[model samples]
Target: MALPAPTTAPTTAERIRSACARAGGAMLAVEGLEPAPTPVHHLLDDGSFATTVPVDSALAATAVSAGAAGVHAVLELTDHAPLPLREPVRSLVWIQGRLRDVPMREVPALLDLVAAAEPNPALLQVNSGITDSGTTTEPEIRYALLRLEIESIVVADSTGAESVPLSALLGADPDPFCAMESCWLQHMESAHRDVVDRLASRLPMTLRRGRVRPLGLDRYGVQLRVEGDDGDHDVRLSFAKPVDDVTGLSQAIRVLMGCPFLNGLRARGV
Candidate 1:
C-alpha cells in the first residue's frame, strides 16, 4: 500500500522557490575554498543564481581560474523566522551546480536581471566607484558577479526533504507574501497574542500543550511551531481557500481565529 500524502497545497517546487526568495542567509561552497559568506544573492527565474564576492577575495580568484569548465559548488540558502523562536530556521535549500564568473562584458545585463528580482545595495556598492572611505572616484570594480548554473536543487524543512526538478522550479513563482511575511508575523507575535491563542485552539488537544509561536505565513496559510518536551510540531492553519491580497488574507485569518472584528494588515505594516 502507498503511504499517505503530505500537505499538497504548496508543492515541493513552490516551497523551494518561495524559500529561496525569502532566504535570510546564503553560503557558497566550492570544492577547495572555504564556504564564503554570501548574505545577499538572488535566485533568477531561470533556476540559476546570481551573487557577488569581493573582487580581490580568494573566492573570486578561484572562480577566475575555473573559467569555462566551471567549478563544482554548492550554494546553501537558509530561511529563518523573523521572531526569536526556538529552532528558528524554517527551511534550507541546497543548490549543487557549476560556479563560474560572469564575463565582465555580461556583468551589466546580469546585474539588471538580479536588480529586477532583488536590488540589494551591495550590488550597487560593487559598481558605485565609491571607495571604502566613501570618496567618489572613477567607476571601479570592487566586486565580481558570479553565476551558479544549477544542476539540482533540494529543499528541506519540517515537512521533509525533496529534490525539485529544474523545470518545476523554473515554472514556480514565489509566494505573494514572502517579502512581507516576516513583518506580518513579527507584528502578530508581538501585538496579537490573543489572536495566536485563538488560532492555536484549532489544533488538537495534545498539540496545545506546547509553547506555540508563529513560524511562517504564505498566501495559503499560517504556520505555527509548537515547542514541546518531545520536539517541535509545525501545524498549518490553512485558509478556507488560497487568498490573493491583503484584504483576503485578513478575512481568512479572522475567519480562522473566529474573530470577525480583527483589523486588516497595512501596506507597510500589520
Candidate 2:
C-alpha cells in the first residue's frame, strides 16, 4: 500500500486559492510569544513585505492564541525519488502571513515541518537563523527549504558556531565564527618530528634489542626512551590523525609524564 500521507493532509496552495478565491488575506495574529513577540516577517513576493503576527508583541501571547487547528500543508515535486517512498521536497510551510522578514531557511530539519504539518497543529517556526542563537537541529532547515516555492520565507547567512540565540539565526551576529572541520590526515610523520629526531639520534645502526622496560605512553604519544649499549634517548612517539586538536599532543605529553624514567627526570624539574 502507498505510504499514508497524514490522515489530514492539508489542501494544496492551488486548492486553498480556489477555495478562498482570495489573492492574499488574513492577518492571522497568533497571539502569544512576545509583548509583540517578534513578528513573523517574510517576503510576500519578490518585493512585497508582510507579517504573520503583530509587530509590538511581547512574544508571550503566541502560546495562548494559536489554537490547535495547526498550519496547513502543501506539497510540490522536485527531482525524481531515489527510493520508492521518498520524493525530493523543495520546501513546505503554512501561509501564516505576508512579511518582509520571516525566520526561515534552506536546511535539513524542515522535514519536521512536513511531519508536524500533517497533524494540522500550530507549527511554531522557532528556528530563527540569526538574531536568535537557539538550539541546533539540521532537519528543521531541510524541510523549510522544501516549501519555499509557495510558502513565504526569508533566509539569512549562517552564524557558524557562535550561536547566542535559541530562536533564530538571521539578524544575529556571533562574536567568533567557527566552521566545520574540513580535512584530516591520520598518522602524520610531521607531527612526530620531535620524537622522530630524538629516536633517530639514539637508535644505533644494526642496534640489537637490549633489555626491554615498559616506560609509558602519554597525551603527547609514547615517551619510551630505549637505553641500548650505544646511547640513551629521551623520546616521544605519536600515532594519531593529524589535523588539529590536543589528542595526539596530549597523549605524547602524558607519555612523558607517565614513563618512569621521564617521571624521575621531570620530578627533578629536568
Candidate 3:
C-alpha cells in the first residue's frame, strides 16, 4: 500500500533549493562556474606532498553578487533548542548544531551575527574538531584544477620544502607566493567537510553529495551548508544575493576564514 505523502514542509536546504529558493540560487553556490580549492604534490624526490593552493568559489563573483543582493539566505542548523533573542534578519544566522570548528578569523563576528539573527539555536552531534591546512588541501587543489576561473595560485608546505627546495633548502623565494591562503582557511575547510559528510549521511532525503560543496552561508537561508547536487536534481534554491564580484567576496571571506566560537552544545562522541 502506498503510504500517504508526508505533509511536513521540506527541510530548509530543500525549500530554498526549489523545494523553496529558486534556480539562480539553487542548491549549488558556484553553479556552472568553478570550485574553490588548494592542491598538494607528492615530490618525486620525497614522499611528502606539497600544497598548490587554489581559492574558494564561495568568494566567486556569483557568490558575492548573491550575498550583496541579500539573496544569500541560510537556515541555522539547530537541534530545536531555545534560541537567543537577537536573531539576524539580514541574510545569515548561526545554526544550532554540533559545530565543527572551521577556524575563520572573524569567528566571533559570525557568531555575534548569528546570535543577533537567529532565534531557536539548537545543537546537533557533529564532527567537533576542525579542518586546517594539513587536512583539506586536496579540496583546494581541486579548485585550482579549473584553470579558467582561477586568477592566482599559492603553494605552501608546512614542511616549507615546496618554496624552499628539499635539496638546496636555502635562498629560496623569500616571500610567499601570490596564491597562498593563510593557514586559517585550511582549518575552516576541515569544518566545512565534516558538516558536509554528516549531512550527506543524516538528511532524510538529499540530492547527491558530489553536486554540492557547502561553502557556508546560503543567501541567509541555510547556514553552514550549501548544496551543489548533480544529476536528476532540481538546482536547490538558495535565497541568497550575489557577492557582486568573486574577488571582493573572496577577500571578505579571507577575513572571516578563522573565526572561533564557544558552541553551546559539545557532543560526547562522533
**TM-scores for every candidate against the unseen true structure:** 0.87, 0.15, 0.18
Per-candidate alpha-carbon RMSD to the true structure: 5.3, 23.3, 24.5
lDDT of 3 at 128: 16
Candidate 1's clash total is 0
Which residues of candidate 2, in runs, are more than 4 Å off?
Answer: 1-11, 19-43, 47-49, 59-93, 96-270
- List, residue by residue over 1-270, the lDDT tens digit for candidate 3: 997753322223222122111111111223344432222111112212111122344433343344323222211211110112122111221211110112335334433433352221210101112355446322212211111121111222111211112333111211111112223224435555554454334333555543333322322122223233332222222222323343533433333332132233334672
Tens-digit lDDT track of model 1 for 235-255: 988886788899989898898
Worst 10 residues of 3 by lDDT: 19-28
Tens digit of per-residue lDDT, candidate 2, span 26-48: 22333332112112223222322
What overall lDDT goes with each candidate model? 0.83, 0.28, 0.26
